[model samples]
Target: MSSATHRTAEEIGRTATGPRPVPPLGEQRFAADLSHVDTELSNGLRVLAVRKATVPLVELRVWIPFAGTDVLHPATAEVLAETLLTGTARRDRIAVDTELALIGGDLGAGVDPERLILNGTTLASGLPTMLDVLGDVFTGASYADAEVARERERLIERIAVSRTQPRTIAREALQKQRYGDHPAVREVPRAEDVAVVEPEQVRALHTASVLPRGSVLVIVGDIDPETIIGDLEKALGGWASDATAARLPALPELSGGNVLLVPRSGAVQSQLRLSAQTVPRTHPRYAAVQMANLVFGGYFSSRLVENIREDKGYTYSAHSGFEFTDQNAVVNIDADTANDATAAALLETRYELGRLGMVPPTAEEVESVRQYAIGSLVTATSSQTGLAGQLTALAATGLGPEWLAEHPARLAEVTAEEVAQAALDYFAPKRFSGVVVGDAELLAPKLTALGDVTVGAPAE
Candidate 1:
């Protein structure tokens, strides 16, 4: 009796408990309010400059709103922008690299769902030389057919490799489901598609789409604004002022209440995508929905993460959030746990979804996330580079800084009822698509109760 009454130190330590340290989060605010810089060139090219004088580096982001959505120009001009730096009108790829090293500079271009941007970085002192290369790539590009073929071959390899990556496959698969096989959702130009793009197509697309009429150039560095903008005008002053308005293609409506299973063999974990049409940046409920997502799965302490990943250890990480697009969009969750735990994990997801429109967040939870979310906003868009990145994205969808500034108030004003309402309105757990990659034979039997399973074989 005496021995039992004396609690061992080991037992005490094992049961030890104290207040859990709260996680870090961001608050709401405008990051770039300190100063703003933008100028339009004589060529009708808009130039935006930000002087982060503290740093010796400067970043340039040039925007052209010709994404793959345009059937006439599906990544033709964008791809050429990439290989342009690889080989110059004056030299080959090797020579360009050699010259770039002399000043520690490089260039690349990317096509997004809504914009085609040419982005690069260089030291502040290296701006003069970098500008020359920028002009050479854009105005004086010599698109030899040989380089186009080479890049197309590499694109095929990339597409092939993407099929094997589970998360990547799930993401692409989800986009395909949400947006259909439309060019907007279709990022990988197939081998056949690549073959159709001739050097002439690249050249023609460049002349037609990559011009100053609707372009915005962002220069971030330690430089004099007046001087830099002056230099930029000289280079672009003679550029074609003809602006060809490119209209965004209409996006398909996001419908709910369905399950799509892409089954794979040798599976250990399952990937899930829950989709719904959401309000655009201009919607009144945008903030409320953002707050709702915060309480749902935007953070680690979020309900989905806390329940499925941390508490249950169903997966390493489980989270969900909305992706804003020109049209209504989808919310997705990705995770990989043991095949056996798939059902339990999904059940938890369903339960959490149900809870959102039910209990709603307490004031404490709302305020905590509000501070974190808003603070997070400032840090996320603090850099000049970050600011410029957002401009083109907003510009593509007919939204801008004016729309973003009102976001905090909208978020702060949201209540638990609104979030619960949003959950009821947007989240569709029953019809969510689940794509599992890995041993399907072993995984499918465990997921029998979830829904009918479709086995997916590799694309030959």
Candidate 2:
């Protein structure tokens, strides 16, 4: 072809009718009617098994409430999660790995102040073997002395590095500022604490905290929900418990006040973390709040991003989203800004927040957010792993697949008036309080000049 005959890329994208008419989005679809079983095994572990035959694979998620008030609980829990799959009575560390590998499976565990989570995947046909391994770990894991020692040392080193991270510093300050002495504030255990955690303590903590009565297991894959329940019963039959898992103490309701400015002596950048209490997923008003959140700062095109990130260039990223814990929920807004832009970033963030409620989202804004919300939900649950994750989270709060299936309709039904009302009720500037972490000398003057900001560190 001659060079002259080759059309440019832009010309190829255009037509005689001018720019092509963008095709309208197809009708939004809700989640399929999943074949599922939501029932409690005799041992008291709630089992939620759903059949989504998208592929010949299975995804598993287990959630167990693991809160504690013991001073060394966090460190012990951390070590326990690392060593949980190291060995059971019937299998040692290498043996456990070999068995899982034979079945194309792998399992891992992690713990936080709120819960201990174990998630994994395997070939669908290997579900029975996977259940067997989980059962062994739950019922009879021997937190071997060597394994405990190794992981504890590694955890101590990791904690040392983590505590120095800006995000970690900001998070700890924010938690303390918000929750005071609540155990939930103790997210990262102290390095000193991990150093002193013994194998005996890890074993004791596992025996007491890793129970079944109040925990939930979610499995999604290409299997029969009805028969899978029987398989689970057979596999985890002996892993019984009379006591429920420990639940974290309820957090005090948050009321907006001052934003604490925590000094990080030489930091060149600042992390602005703001939070406000809000309704949980099961709340009737959550759909409206969800849309309101997207319009404010939940997505790339939100008002906050448009103002501080795109226009003013104060931040490269700014985000707002909800964090759910058991039955409680709160919205968190965060941005990392250069030291010079820190105070201005906070000011613009609050400005957008106030604007969201006062001006509210227009019909077009409402529709855009609504579509985004529904589309995100659908995309998130389209696969087995995604569905399993969604179910595990919902099951922790006593919900099931039915709730997931109906959420799209709920979002679609949310009106512009409702979203605006949610904005006013939830996104008011006065309804938020948080921490700004940076050099006190650099940020103190401008941040203090802005009212409702206090200088100094959060209380220990």
Candidate 3:
């Protein structure tokens, strides 16, 4: 084992034939058809159940439209979600916990500007017990005063800290800039607002907002699809209402404009966020647009990452992807960079955007991203939890498992020319507007000089 007897690392990696050629991808496999039932219960809840039988566990996802226009809606909604599973008339917090623990099950609730989501997991044998517990909460949850007081204080403290984070500040600024006064801009409630939220207010909000008419429930795991529907009907039978769940108003379409510069005095780093409107999943050109996105910055090997992160070292991470709302979708590009590199990073990002349209991705690039799109879809849906989540998202927009099963073929049929056309049509630099969070005095001169940038007041 002398040093001289062993080859160096470089020599070991190379051969006399000069490095190896990358193997071509094999034939892509499509997802198999799953036995599922999609129907509506008497209580007005749409239920989708699939039999995966991969394990003894069942994954549950419930999505309810929870939009509101009251001034205190966000604060009241936050408190409601915090205490939703804390108690019911038949079970207190500990009793609820014990019942679920005995059956290897757990349930939680969360809310945002658009929806209230409840996620749960349980042994397949415990499915009926889980449904009964869910029904108990839906029908008679007593939001105790003590529980409300304690959770409200904790939420206030967390909000105080979250509002101070750089990313949070940038997100708020971007939302305001892009959507103006849309209710979707109200993501985080104010601490003062939470402090004033009384327990009765939380209870009233729960009774008024958490309806079943406009909601969907998705279940995937070891079970019979047909029999499970009857079981769901029996369990959620009494939780009915004549009113439909509230839905958020449609967001105004985004158009290209100047980037806003929000000052964060003495910051050592900066946040770069950019967005533009795009086609929804149901659109005919969605497949092509998806491929174009992957080639731009949706994955690690994208052109934007190669330019800024690997070659220039301007940032540690950079990404571009789509965000879907109701029936609309928008593409977002984001990167965090050192203060010194902010201006140059912005320049390069715009440069790549312009170049993408002028010089589109080649056939090889299209093929690489195409395989990635299909492979990722198949891989993501291969599990019970993953498939449930995918179906839930699709269900939110009036789609079902059928759309998920047919997506791979759509990606396969997208041509390189179609991808190129999507790139030119959607990724143009002029079609984006966003905000940069940094020290304005330092970033202003250079950013303003870059054109299409305006400086705003310092962040409070």
Best by lDDT: 3
Predicted structure 3, TM vs. truth: 0.96
Better structure of 1 and 3 per lDDT: 3
Worst 10 residues of 2 by lDDT: 22-31
Give the candidate order by descending lDDT.
3, 2, 1
Model 3 vs truth, CA RMSD: 1.9
lDDT score, residue 25, model 1?
Answer: 53
- The TM-score of predicted model 2 comes to 0.96
Cα-based lDDT for every prediction: 0.68, 0.91, 0.91
Clashing pairs in 2: none
Worst 10 residues of 3 by lDDT: 23-32
- Order the candidate numbers by TM-score, best to worst: 3, 2, 1
Counted clashes in each candidate structure: 17, 0, 0
Residue 319 shift from truth in candidate 2, angstroms? 0.3
